[model samples]
Target: MTDQLTYLLQKLDASAHRYAELDKYYEGRQPLAFLSPEARTALGSRFGRMASNIPRLAVTALAERLRITGFSDPALWADWVRCDLDQTSGTAHREALLLGDAYVIVWADRLGRPAVSVESAKQVTVMTDPGTRQITAAVKRWEDRIAKTSTAVLYEPDRITRLVANQIGAVGSGFKVVDEIANPLGTVPVVRLHNSDRILDRHWHSEFDGRGHSEIDDLIPLVDALNKSLADLMTTSEYVGRPRRWATGIELTEEPVLDEDGNETGETVEVNPLPESHRMMISESPDSKFGQLQAADLQGYEASVRVILGQIMAVSTLPAHYVGVFTDNPASADALRAAEASLTARAEARQATFGRSWEQVAKLMIAVRDGRDPQLIDDVRVQWADAATRSVAQEADAVVKLHQAGLLPVSTALAKLGYSADEIAEIRVARRAEALDTAGLDLGRPA
Candidate 1:
């Protein structure tokens, strides 16, 4: 047991470091940290400070655009899960989009109302059984910087426990468990949300077990190049525009002159080809012309920037138009679809992983709210929104065709077209009422 705990602690420490590195990249800091000291010095502070943050932007864009298309929004779950989600601010969706690894901890608030909140990756570490890949435990450690203390919550299958320590070692260091307590929540109250699963030679690892790769991993180099290029351009522009003043073959002499009192008075006089002046004073010699610094070719820098952006678009699988660059003509609908195919596929893949986590969250929420066994709510599933862009008319037409051809039911078709269960039910009720009113009028019978 001690050896197992030590190994888990070591893994947690490594994960913390990995998470911190990812966070730094996402926040656009330390872009040139990997460079050697000599190389970094050569780049200077301006280049070091210039961060395009394209990687961050690309990842955020994908996460934001990958909307949750569907979930347990039917009438069966209206009171149990949907209402609770509304009260909790739809945390599952928000957390899934922002954090690659999201955790939901369920508990009852002071008023005994079931509550759920997203936990930061820094504070939560998940432990899973290697064979079954089932979460065996989840440990949450938080430190009070001001109080010089730390607290850890350990959630297991049969119980929820707390550990308090006066001082906790850095990530991998084993902490002294000074105190422990079991909580009222009998079962593990946390669920791990992974953006994607990692595979290894027919074996699978949870996102928590390994370092999760970000969507913008391939675009980091392009972003760095773009920023460096921009910094160089700015420096060149400053040098070219700097104030220039020069003087040559000029001399100053002090001459004695008689003042009004007939006493000797001295005054400095310019004894050169040109008068002393703040402006560029040209000398009489033909070889002494005013020198001017030529500006660098800004067009070249602009072209390089465009090329870097193109590379980002290609590697990230994002559309050129979406990245703020466009051709003379608007892209056709088919072209647009083709361009977004890769991005849509990536979003769908994320949905597959994140969807399951959401299902677990829904189950936990139901358990907390109704005091039912979470394991019993196994049928909960997530519905993701359409990953592709389509016009409203196109979507509605497709759904109507499917419904008329008997390929899909009206309710299902409406749901696929992004209609909520409540809206679909209301539409059906209104249609029935109109039919009844028309029959009562007897307009078809008489006319």
Candidate 2:
């Protein structure tokens, strides 16, 4: 038991290092310390933080579109809402997208109802079986700064042990057992929601288990480039993006100096009458005509920034417009669909992978609530909101054609038309009532 707790704590610390770095970028904290003070001055405050939020944008653009509507099991779906999975899942999903994986811990509340909560990767880490990818042991560690104490919870397949240390840094020295809880589910109650949880295709992910690929990891470099270019542009605008007027034959007029008491002094002083950054310049000689030094050509810097954005698009499933590149005229419906094809595909992939994890979570919730076999809810399925961007006419036309062709069922057609579950149920009831009324009437003879 001691050896297992020690190993899990080590793993927790290792994972925290990576999570810290990712969290910094996701929160718009620039990783690079500028070499020059001017660059910092230009991009250090509000504008800089805003420009560095590209990584944040990349993660959220897809996350916001992915919503879990319902579960296939009606009773489970009802329980899902009662458990407040809607709000908790929103927070968990976005964090998963940002940090690669987020865990949901299931337990029973005081009311004997299933309680679900999201744990961030920063504070939680788990060791998974290599073949099954099921968590063998998990630990969540947190420090109470005010009390100068740290607490760690180790979650195993059969038991949950809570341990504590004197200080956050002393977690390695050892911890005394503070509490323990029984988990009879025979599996860990924590379920992981992953973003791009694929094996190592590139150098981005670890070859080991218990980790998933982050959504913004690869985009961080591009985000840095974008921020760098933006800082440069802003610096240029502050230094030279504005027009400067130069005079070839201006005279420095001399005036008698005045003493502090307003008495004239013998010394004469020369002062250039032109104010700094003034819009106009005046001189007595004809050669004094002002020649303006045009503002710096920003196309190069902006083009470089756009090139970085283009590279991001090339590597990821994001489209050009998602990164803020826009055209003079709005894209045609077909063009917009074509552009967002990859994005939609990515969202679907998330729905598929995340759906499986959610199923596990639902099973855990039920098992915690009713002490029943999870396999009883084997028919569980995740219902995702439509991620496609289509016009109203287009959706209606496709739904009508598919339903008439017998390719899509009426219930499915209503779903395609963006009807909610409750709305569709109401529609079906109304239809049934209308059918009964028609059957009772003598329409054939009256018409």
Candidate 3:
């Protein structure tokens, strides 16, 4: 038991560090410290200053795009879990996208009714068995600064252990077990939703197994470059507008002055310096031809920044037109579709991983509500919104063609055209009602 607790504590600390690193990037802070002056300025004479500015544009853009393309629709699956999700603030999906993972904890409320809630990665950590790669326990650690206390809720397969510590850092107070309750679900009540998965011996193999990488990791360099390029451009602009100059044939003059006591005092000196503002400085001779320091050609820097942004889009699988400014005509539908193909693929990949977690959450909700194991709800699947960018006319034509070819039913085609199951069912019922009304007969009456 001691070993297990120690292992979980170690894993929790590691996960916390990973989360902090990712969070730093998300918050527009540099995750890595600037290199030493000796290393960065090795070839100092010719090169410019080190690019140390931290910009969050790439992280912000990637995260926003992922949230829009990945989890814009929370209740994509059209199931009982949707109800539970709706009961929350409807930010569970957004949290998952931002944090790379989110947690759902299922339990019974005061009325003994099943309830579900979301937990950010910062507050929750999970420990998985090495051999099975299955979650053995989950911990919810939170600090109450106002109350000057820290609480840890350890959820195991059969029971929940709540531990409280008076001082925050003094974990040695040894988590005093305040309460223990039997887990009715008979399994870990927490489900982990991951953004992506990694292979074994790798970082992220299972749902609760790894610290999934955030979408912003790859775009950090590009974002830094973009910011630096912009800074250089601004510097160039300032230099061009107010060129620096040097004054020549100017000398300092000193003259002795009388003091208040009528005695010879220190000499008063006059030192003439070049004008500091953006005005012409008068020179004594034609030899002093106000020379301007060469301002960098900003065109190259601007173009390089654009290129970096393009690379960011390409590597992140986001559409170029979406992130970059478009001066030319808007891209055609086919062109747009081609551009978004990679983004669609990425969204699909995320769906596959997050979907399983949603399924588990749904099953847990069912188990809580019905007092059943919910093993029968295996078929409960997540319904993802269409990730592709297509015009309505194009989608309608394709659906029509599929229906004409007898490859899909009309209802199924409509569903494929982005209609939810509930909406489709309602449409079908309305059509049936209209048909019955047209027949001028009530099915309940014996006409």
Clashes of each: 6, 0, 1
**Compared with the true structure, what per-residue lDDT tens digits does model 1 show for residues 293-387?**
55456788888888988888888877777677766223676676777788787777777777777677677766666678877766787776687
Predicted candidate 3: what Cα RMSD to the true structure? 6.8
List candidate 1 stretches off by more than 4 Å.
Answer: 1-10, 32-48, 72-100, 107-114, 168-187, 200-208, 240-294, 328-330, 369-372, 404-406, 422-447
Alpha-carbon lDDT of model 2? 0.77
Off by over 4 Å in 2: 31-52, 169-173, 200-210, 248-271, 277-289, 328-330, 375-379, 405-409, 426-447
lDDT of 1: 0.64
Writing each residue's lDDT as its tens digit, candidate 3 over 1-447 gives 445555555556656766676666656554223334563344343334333332244333333323211122333334343444633423555556656668888887776666777888787768777887677888888888998887888899989988888866324246788899998788899887766657542354432346656666676667666655655565556556344566556654555677899777776756445537536577576665546565456678778777877777677776666665575325698888887787777766766777778777767766776688756655566565565778999999998999999999977787778775666778999999999796776566685
Using TM-score, give the best candidate's number. Answer: 2
- For model 3, name the residue pairs that clash: 198-204
Q: What ordering of candidates by TM-score runs from best to worst?
A: 2, 3, 1
